[model samples]
Target: MQCDICQRSPSSRLPFNCTLCARNTLYQPRIQLAQSLLQKEALEKEVDQNVAGTPKPTRIIPAPGGKPSEPNPSWIVQRAAAEQIVSEEKTQGIHDHVKTLREEIQNTKAEIAARKARLQKRRSEFASAKQELSKSQTGAVENMDKSMRRTEHRWDILHNKTAESRLFLCREAALLYGLHQRKRKKGGLGRDVYFVGGVPIADLRDLNSMDSFDYGLRQADSSIDASPAHVTTSNTNLAHLVHLVSHYLSLRLPAEITLPHRDYPLPTILSPGSSYTGREVPFPGSTPSHSSNNSPSASRHADQRSLPRPRPLHLDKKLSALAKDDQVAYASFVEGIAFLAWDIAWLCKTQGLNVGGNSWEDVCAMGKNLWQLLLAPPPRPSVSREPSSKTPPQKPSLSRPSTAAARTLQPENPKDVPPLGHFSHGTAYGYLATASGTEYMRDWGLQHPLRVIEKVKAMLLAERTGAEWEILEGNEWEEEEAGSEAKKETKKDVVRPGIEETVILVRPGGVESGINEGSGGTEREESDGKGRGASGWMKLKSR
Candidate 1:
């Protein structure tokens, strides 16, 4: 059964609390992490010890001062000092007899020197002739050229290794993402949906829109969803955001926003890969393989002798999926990507979380950022509301557009509002239309560790103020305390026929029925302050 607060299946085994509840209730996840880290460290050590030809140090004994001396001296020391001295004196007499032999050798050496001087004169002439024959240019320049080539070769090898390792990491991250996607379809470990500030959101929706988000739901072809799913269009939701943040702040998406460079920047478009280096040895029986086959595809690319050749720009394999977009979109994607990377860096260092490999770190980290993105408030509305924007609030109850300042949450003129306001008409009710279409928020189970619904709900419900108190309640009976609660139940009937009925996943504080049942709309058209009695959007004070 789902926990009332987090609405997740808690782990029931002895000594094991529910992982969902554990996350909500506990501040640290140390024990499980410590065990995993210890295991990895052991594996690394085992690998290190198995490598071949590692050297071992030598052992030695010490001497008093001089190093080890002659073995005969050691024996002599063992004998009595007088006996050793007498033996040495007898040897000296033999040495005097050898002195006569030395004199005779000196006389022979003098004769030999005279003959050698004549031989040396002949050798000198031949040596000079040989030097003339081999007058090669063996100068400092040649030595410098050789050293430089070696350095360049080493640089190339290092570069290729670094690039390949990075590519492997990116590929791994993509694979991990794919696994999470499949698990979500099978409903294995449900980390897809999570709540933040009490609002439920799906990570897949952030990555992909709603129509494409549903998977495990009933389908006609398979068992997922027997009938075609009815989904609200994304435009209306965009309208609701305009009502909530932009309309108030009057901000809009800027003409442009400055973006930072990539998490790992690529090289110049014109330059070839770093200078080539060390060759790869052939595998086992392939000893005949080329000596320099080690470099990656990018560096090994040949036939580019022409000037300013175009280079193939490949991203790290893990990051390659992101490399497909056009410049502007690529730039936009990176902003979110960089933010995710920063978050991972923080978690790995501060939380002591075991991130495992580069791929795991990248995907999970991206999921983390995607999870928080829901809390990122919309930009204020534009200087002038776009034609597509909610019609100037007048006649708002109907679908008709008006040129006047439509009655909205603000102090709208009677002229601003039509006699028949768009209570459920126009795009004004888009948020309600949106809330009804929460399937878009379900994809989080596939991409994150926390189920999407729980995370979003927490963000929306955790610190409910007087305004949000009713929406966060666990049951329908208790939700009536909110002033707007009455209208919420009434509004459930307002949904167009064939759309799914109200089903809110209460979290953090408790389970909730329909959000509308307890949390009624502000009477936006008539509201004086930020509160619009029936139409204004609710906002997080915590943000």
Candidate 2:
């Protein structure tokens, strides 16, 4: 048999169990029970001994009417001790709560003090910043005032300089061109007036104004053939003046100039060396001695209406950009000026005048600034008339005449005469010296001359198109097309030969009207001459 606890064969007579292990297990519970019983009895004996050693409390009775007897001393002492213990516990809790509240109050005061310090620092910073802002604002205002004052002073100086320069140029130009100054009374006021060959050209105060000069030129051109004896000499002088101005300024003119004449095939242009003698053309019905006033108004109107508009001399980029009507107006204005210049040059040769002096270089040098103000800028390299070559063009040698007689004598050779562009070289130097001058010259040329050209252009355009001229930004002029249509209608009614001929058709019903109607009629008639009825065509002669 095997023992379960020891895993050994049992030597006892029990079934499948060791006799020594069984005896130990059975006696272990009994030994533990006996030790517990002994411990419980010992505890009980100690409690009984404690009870026996303690004295019992005695009870007392009081008489009915007697006061309550005093309490037992031991009971009083125990109750007093319990009350003292509770009082100590309450005092400790109160002290703890008071300490905690005091700590919280101290922490709150610290936080408030820190916040106040931060606020004070922010206030001081704000005040300093405000003072700095005030100082900076005052300084900026003072600077602005100083700059404005400086600008005003500069503007005043520039205005004075411009006025002085204009006066000098006008005086020099008048002296050189033989303009005489006179005091004229008008409207109960006396003013200095400049006269070119007895014709009032401009007032002294308006010498700087280009419009004044252009208006004067137009008046002089209209009065060219007014009289014969007195006006001839005056016109000769005027022509000399116009020639000098045009030559020195290098003003561009049309290729031909049409002068008002009685000749049938009128003198289209006056050649450089040719002399012009006024001649009368004998028509089929008119005699050579018949004056224009003796002719019928209908014949005069027909003659005037038949004349064609002159073509432009050259179509540069600027002229090419303009409308057809504008180009005609421009050509007419330039050609009129060219005629005055060309006529004088022709007359100078016929009269045997020694006016072609070789003192052009001296004159240019003496009035350098004046020439710069009057002469137009040189043409661009692309448009320059100079021949293309690697070598530069040589400057003409100026002849210094020794005696007064020699100075009065004309040059023997034509090559000795200075070229027209040489007179403008001094003006060109002024422009070519600086970038700003180059740009200004390229765009507008000299200021006064440009203004004169613009004024003449506007006047010619107004005369031709009946458009009101209006000044725009940058001193540019624009023509208003408000009354242009009416003017164009009037122009269409008057047919010019070899330019535009309006055809009128007479139907069987006696109705006569133009071949086409409206503005597009001219274009249609010129393009294909289509859509015309088979009626008889009648040309409307100007009355």
Candidate 3:
């Protein structure tokens, strides 16, 4: 038969007790005790009957059966012995059960204690892990905060530099326009002069209306006062700056016809040597590239005569793509070009030169030639070649344009310059509207770094401040002339401001660098303790 509790087949060799039947066996102790009491009662009754009321007259019929062994005294003695043995056996069984129960109790207590100790150990481990996790999270947060701070610092530096550039360009354009206006008044050119687009010069919008520099300056100063350490611009501020510059340039150069100077400032910062150097060298394969036999004087003379070549003014396709992707940057680049053109025009007008013309080719040619003179190299013997079977040896000419030579040449009249064609608005603005053309122009604009704006501003600031003076005395004329020629040579070259000339650090007072703006200091002291003296340009602060 199957057991009821465990549902297993019962074993035949042992008792067929189920799990429930075994649990019910705990009542066996009471049953055993009852049975022992009953046996004792029965034995006592028999003994009483035999001892007190034994009326079973074993008459004299068995008188001969020995004296009946004294009615079996042996029976009473045996009964007493049996009773004692049963009592002792029952007591031993109870004692053994109690001992087994005590051992079980001890084993259970030990198990419970071990379980509690294990639980406490686990709890401590959990607590330590939790604490470590919290520490790690705190450290991660701190590291993130530090990273953000560094990124913010870098952004501030870039933003401030950009702001300064924008301000300098605006101020320069304004000053230059003012100068042009004054000269125009003096010459009777009339503000009503009609441009190729039929728009009167006077009709152009004034730059003063788009003065983001002043607004930004105020905000920057306020920010500096509020924090005195870190200052940043909102997107709104940056967009406003871009719009202001773009609008100003639009008004200044409304159309290509309204271009301040005929391709003035050209697309390149430097003019090419072969085209503008005014001298020619024999074909490359005809002669060796260098001659070791030339003396130091000859080499020096050659160096003085040779001007640095102009960088090609072509647009880089890759850079153009990058610029096109950034509309604001592209706009900034165009505006920068417009500012440079305006400045050049003003410079030419002040020198009593005509910059306006109708012929595109002529304008480009004139601008290039002008650049050659403005950035003339040190006086060198002009190279002239004589006819010979072999490549003619070149001879250097001594004649070079100087103040003396400049005084002799007459500037052309604008009226005499031929017009190429009627101005077309579509052609002028069309290129800018397209991606490819815009990118191309952007590439050209980037040829000149933004630092040029700083240089120009520094130059203008020095002139305005007037705290510095240049002395032309004694033999200083000859020396000055030579220096002036050298200066012109590097003008069109890719010249950049020295470290002393740039705003290296922003300070609470304003801006700080090694540049000294004061005029009274010794030459060495002015050049940051170097003997070179301060450069012609001085450093400027944003304010």
The model with the greatest lDDT is: 2
Query: 1 or 3: which has the higher lDDT?
Result: 3
Per-residue lDDT tens digits for candidate 2, residues 1-543, read: 455677655455455355656765467678777766765665555444334444233222333344433434665556567667878999999999999999999999999999999999999999999999999999998999999889878765554443334333433443544454332233322222234545443211221122323333333463232122322233334444444443444332222233334543322333222222233224222344434455576456444422233322222222212334465544542443333433333222221222223321111111111222222111211212222222211221112223343334333554433222222222432222356433423322222222333444554445435322221222121132343345445644544445354444333233234423432111111111121221223333322
Clashing pairs in 3: 358-420, 381-396, 381-397, 382-396, 382-397
Q: Report, for every candidate in turn, its global Cα lDDT versus the true structure.
A: 0.30, 0.37, 0.34
Q: Model 1, 1-543: lDDT tens per residue?
A: 556754555454434345656654453466556656755665444334323222122122223232422223433344446455767887887787688678778878987997799789878977886675444435455777798889878765554443333223322322222212112233222333322121222232233212122332211122231111121111112213212322222222111111113421222121112112122212112222333465677446733342222121222221212333343333333333232233322222111122222232223322333222212101211112112222222111212112121111112232322111111112332121254323322221223322322333243233233233212323443453353445545644544434443433322223334334444322211111111111122221211
Which window of 10 residues has the lowest lDDT sum in candidate 2?
Answer: 360-369
TM-score of each model, paired residue for residue: 0.19, 0.27, 0.21
Query: Can you tell me which runs of candidate 3 are displaced by over 4 Å?
Result: 1-97, 127-136, 162-543
Tell me the TM-score of model 1.
Answer: 0.19
- List candidate 2 segments past 4 Å from native: 1-94, 121-125, 163-543
Q: How does residue 31 of candidate 2 score in lDDT?
A: 77
Best candidate, TM-score: 2
Q: lDDT tens string, model 3, 255-282?
A: 1111112333223222211333434332
Please report, as a residue range, the 10-residue window in candidate 1 with the lowest summed lDDT. Answer: 525-534
Model 2 lDDT vs. the true structure?
A: 0.37
